[model samples]
Target chain A: MHSDRAPLGLKVAAGLGLAFMHLPILLIFVYAFTTEDKSYQWPPPGLTLKWFAVTWGRPDVWQALWLSVKVASISTVIALVLGTLCAAAVSRTKFFGREVISLLVILPIALPGIITGISLRSAFNLADIPFSFWTIVLGHATFCVVVVYNNAVARFRRVSGSLVEASMDLGANSFQTFRYVILPNISTALLAGGMLAFALSFDEVIVTTFTAGQQQTLPIWMLEELVRPRERPVTNVVAMVVVLVTFLPILGAYYLTRGTDTVAGQGK
Target chain B: MTSAIRFSGVSRHYGDVRAVDNVDLDIAEGEFFAMLGPSGSGKTTSLRLIAGFERPTAGEIRIFGQVAQGIPPYRRNVNTVFQDYALFPHLNVRDNVAYGLMVAGQPKAQRHGAADGALEMVALTGYGDRKPSELSGGQRQRVALARALVNEPKALLLDEPLGALDLKLREQMQEELKSLQRSLGITFIFVTHDQGEALSMADRVAVFNEGRIVQIGAPETIYFRPETPFVADFVGSSNVLPPEFVAQLTGRKAHGALRPEAVHLSEQGHSATVRSVSFLGAATRIGIRIGDVPMTMLLPKSDTFPKVGDTVTVNWAAEDLHVMDRA
Candidate 1:
């Protein structure tokens, strides 16, 4: 049915929108292995895998990649645990200032990231703490928690509270209820949230600018490479890798979340 | 008898509205006790309090000879078959049934064996690998029962467990659950808004209204001698007659309730014109107007039915007339 029928105008509009969104990334991948020049070039160049080897050989690239991975890993782990706890505590209990707590966690993402970065930087300066890896991890985590917390809280609400009561009434304690009941129920949501948090931390640039002292994350390295030495092919190669690494998890997460909603209307 | 479940001066108020008010009750051991009430009558809240899901605002709950205040639900030797069943959607039937034992760290073989036995008891022997979503409503309900029974709780608290089923399935499950309770000989505290289910299945029933226990007795007593007008009206479809109609026999302001079955169409007694007659196969229900109060009388369908506008005498034994103080 899809292949045989569609209005021309609507189909063209949809095609244009998809191309507009993805054409630049496709171009980046195409030119990333080009052998023509130091400048970004189109179809004239021959293809080569040499730029990837060059990128792998650079000590500076490896250092920045390692730093980025370390920060993203730490930030994702911290965000997962803290976000799950916050979601559980807020969802399970009735208390004063619940809306305020919700607002605080969500505010980091809703407000401009620059504002979050500057405020965190100022707070760190006042506390007499030096800018370092931990600070960068902390800064990236501020926004990453918002992603994890929002996802986790939404999933927690979807789980029936009666299930918790049923578990408890059947002689399962609170921790066991969470582990065997609540956790498995929300596992897919948490998995999706964790992937998004890792992607966010891996690519985060603005907050890292304020939080990093001498350390160079991959994004910072890319920024420096773009402005200083015009090593266009090597930068494109790195960008291609970054796009692929981040894209797969996001696609997996989208599929994971989509499965639930597709069958939701059927049952209800 | 030492009470299996006791509530003494128990009360719970959500803000200013009392959900359960200064209630006192003693449910006997091994009895299939039911709390029957309309929605908002605090029956479910009292069950939750006894289950330790909710803390009483005042007084105490004693379960199996132990004070239940501040004790979590997991520590209480009582399980609940929730109104919604609330089966774990992600777990297979076996895992869900074994959840309580697994939580208590029972060994793998013992846990699986116990769960299997419980599943067999509920007639879900071969469906252990399927998730809750895969089961039919009745099967899911049986899984819920099996899950609760596997723990072998001292008592099982059922909060309208059959409320979600279709009528035929509900009837079948009711018989199954009642028989299961008798065979186990464990105390079963059941809650339902359906009076037929309560009266037919309960060994004894507690009638609740407006957050208080209005009456507690055997199913026959609850049906025949409801303590209040509310209980009478709530428990059965009563044809409420004004005091004036029965005043010559009972007294002034003594509200009278006649079970539709108790009133008969006779050639002699108080006369009323038939408004409508419904022949319901097994029985016929005749709606009549006696003065201003609307009255209904049930007669065997084999007996002659009065036609509309036909004047007929509605007669009953004086002892079948129930006099109550409140409506």
Candidate 2:
């Protein structure tokens, strides 16, 4: 219960915490404009925009970025369809082992990324499936579905059962009830979930590393460029772009879900 | 003439728990009917069954003499004003009221005109553009009623639609709903746990207890001539005389039920000592002990009300006493 004017100690601690989290990202932005061609330097000798032209000239960077966008978009679409259905089934009905099914759906995201990555890699090898774009999309969707399901299920539970019954009783069949009543209630949640799932899939690196065999997603390319330095500022510039691309949706999702808890006639 | 809605030997069970047990009822056309009961008393279950939200475990439900065994709610010619007034949050009042028509593929201009008419009926014509969240509780309730009535179904089911309002608003809405039903002349089947609500608004009320219809009759008949002890105690405040007590007083081995208002404070009859006196605005309720049996009597409020510890005599006309079997 801190007041509007927090204590001096708390204010300083909060500042330190934020700085700890964002200092490296700030450094990435600063280095993206630096003229340094080889290694990172404090106070970056001088700033220049030449790296933007060089990054744009690289076909490999374009390939990786396009691949990453494709994978995240397809993964998000898959997550939305499957996640909404799962949420509807879990929240709207009672069945045997429903809780177990919910637990299983969330387990992929809860487990360590390396474990998920390894399991996917081994499963792909055993099944004789090639490590391609579809494999990377599959790996990202495993966790993306969890994000969407979490948001959708919470909203579904909040929508009153009476709303659905009212729709049906007012001469709307099951399909119409979902379209008019259930859809309007859960639309914001589904949108927020989709945005969050897209953001999560965009910058994912560990899972992509295991699933991608000759293909390189944006994060994978950044890793390779870090190992072998050639026009180093280009990597930093690309990293800055990745940060912006992922940050916008996450921020948008936060605002979308902030006011979703208050539904009309819910308390009454 | 066909009954508006009929349930024949309907029994709905969830595993071993019987929600509605072998209930047979007939609601006449253009009559205001009420199913009155406490929580878990099968009243709400009966409403849902009629709405097609729940199927009966056995027997049949008929609408206008046609079997509604497998009919869905949308296909059945009835709409429900849900207890919580389940208005759509995303839509404004006009869109919410027009939803039933929109689903039926009515033209936009026709549905909008019909929605305005429905809103006007509820005295909410100017509130069309406002969201459900923007309306007050009473206003939202009217919108829900408008939404259901816009379809002009054969019968309308209301599941405690006034349960969420404050006391004053609830009383006001009760009168409004009764007058609205009269003007519409459509069959209304209402469900409520509040006996006062059922008594005030319904043409005939069904008293339910433990998954059975304990008694069904007009409000006056239910209050004065209850067929069972449960109905006698539930429909109103009544003194149910035990069989032994009745035998001692009337010299007959029978049970009796009498309303508190029926027993008046008198100069001579059955002698009793006043144990408690409660001043209830328009009336004074005096609790007394007549030999080992406790009884209550309601008397007109006056300056000469009896005080506790005072000895008094209470009397009732023979016609006021209702004979009933032991339950």
Candidate 3:
């Protein structure tokens, strides 16, 4: 429908809609080096790399950046393991309430982020768990698993059941089949999913807001700096870094998945 | 000394649908046994049962006299070449071939040498670095065959391994597969819907129809002495005529199956009119109507083909006719 040469009105509407969605992001990229301090000015008087140098030198900025990387990496790893297992179990096995289990795994992310954050916060409070690196990792994993699970499950479904049978018939046990056949087939999907999960975890703030008590991740740190008047350009600098770090892999994930229509898109 | 594999009264049912009805078969060691049938004939199901992919409903399956009931596929002494080949897309030909050995915990050096040898056997040497996607359909098929055959199992179950290939490739691979089986001296259970594939390659063929084995014998026996109408019609190009047409010829049943090649276009025998003539390269197949009954007769290219409107005499030897047990 989008490819069709419709009236100029429809094409202009679509173009405008796309511009509306991305214009703010484009502005951030454009204004990251602008001399203007507080509010974003369209026509900046001058541009400089001074903010990037300042952003690099700040110890607090480095701490928050490192924390974000650590949390995203740890959460992505955990999510990859658990989510792949969940996908394999659901896809390869026939069990009662399989659909319900799948829905439950994806439910945390499918619901509004605020809802997920509030509920997770309540659950953690009731369990008497304090906020820490582990808590942040755990909270991020709840949604990150959905991403990995979705990727792995879609890849698993693309793999033929007969391939597993052929592997077993050729003297591969379940583990060997998984290692030699199943793992290789699903590796791309896992990689794509992990990259996506890392990106999501890196930028996630709503869920982190309720979970993190004192630890300020990069996004949280950016939010704090955005509110305060001092060092506002530094937030834009950090935002520029965040965009670069996350955007590359999201683009990579799209190319990896867009080659074939994944099984996850079966109904849609 | 004993048969390579045996299935005694094996049956598989999915709820009410009997996928494989009670079947009894004994495949001799080193013999190429093929299951020839149309789709949904239980040939694949029987092969899977022997491979231990699924357990029989109520019967015994033995691999070299060892009961295979409840035995998992990995533990069984058999490998399968699936219809789609199922070659691991990530692994190259060599890795895919060595997968079974690697899974068996064989050392890397030994497995690698074995893999190289297997790839050489399949004429896929120097293809170890290229993934399955890089190979053509025929190359992929060879890789699949090498992967399964490298394990040196007691028997190999090929489930329509040539089904995906075009006619030309299929025929060429059929010869290669037969030679491979012969050289290895491994018992082979091949399943295919194409009768020509089964007849040309197998030492003996089992004809299947609707989840049951209709007949089991050598290719000659199946072609010449079919026991049922299904086998007669399925095994080769045959003309099934009602028993009344051959009543005067044979005093038995009211139906018989005659091979197109067996029916002659000579100047002697039963009288008929040429309905149509099809020039099929080396052979000319003519359709003839004899007293309201239509039949086909195959003749060598050297023989004169009767025109469509011409009258021709179509007949066969007295012993060439086989009575089909009409169900």
Best by DockQ: 2
Ranking by TM-score: 2, 1, 3
lDDT of 3 by residue, B1-327 (tens): 579998899899988889899999999999999998999989999998988878889889889989998789999988998888887766776778898998888998899899989899989889988877778888888888888888988898899988878889989999999999889999999999999898899999999988889899999898888877677778886888787876767877557889999888667877898888899898998888988888888898784568998987777887788777654
Q: Please give, for residues B213-255, the per-residue lDDT of candidate 2 as tens digits.
A: 9988999988888888788888876888787888776777677
Clashing pairs in 1: none
Query: Tell me, what's the RMSD of every candidate?
Result: 2.4, 1.6, 4.5
Candidate 2 deviant stretches above 4 angstroms:
A1-4, A264-267
> Which pairs clash (backbone N, Cα, C closer than 3 Å) in model 2?
none
lDDT string, candidate 2, A149-244, tens digits: 999999988888888888888888899988888887898899999999999999999999999989999999999999999999999999999999
Model 2: what is its DockQ? 0.70
Off by over 4 Å in 1: A1-4, A43-46, A262-268, B325-327
TM-score of 3: 0.85
The Cα local distance difference test for each model comes to 0.88, 0.92, 0.87
Tell me the lDDT of model 2 at A163: 84
Model 1 agreement with the true structure over B1-327: per-residue lDDT tens digits: 768999999999999989999999999899999999999999999999989999999988999889998799999999998888888888888998998999999998999899999999999999999978888888888988999989998899999988889999999998998899999999999999999999989999999988999999998887888767777788887766667776876775777778999988677888888999898888888899876778888888674666899988888988999887665
- Candidate DockQ scores, in order: 0.56, 0.70, 0.40
Give, for candidate 2 chain B, the lowest lDDT window spanning 10 residues: B247-256
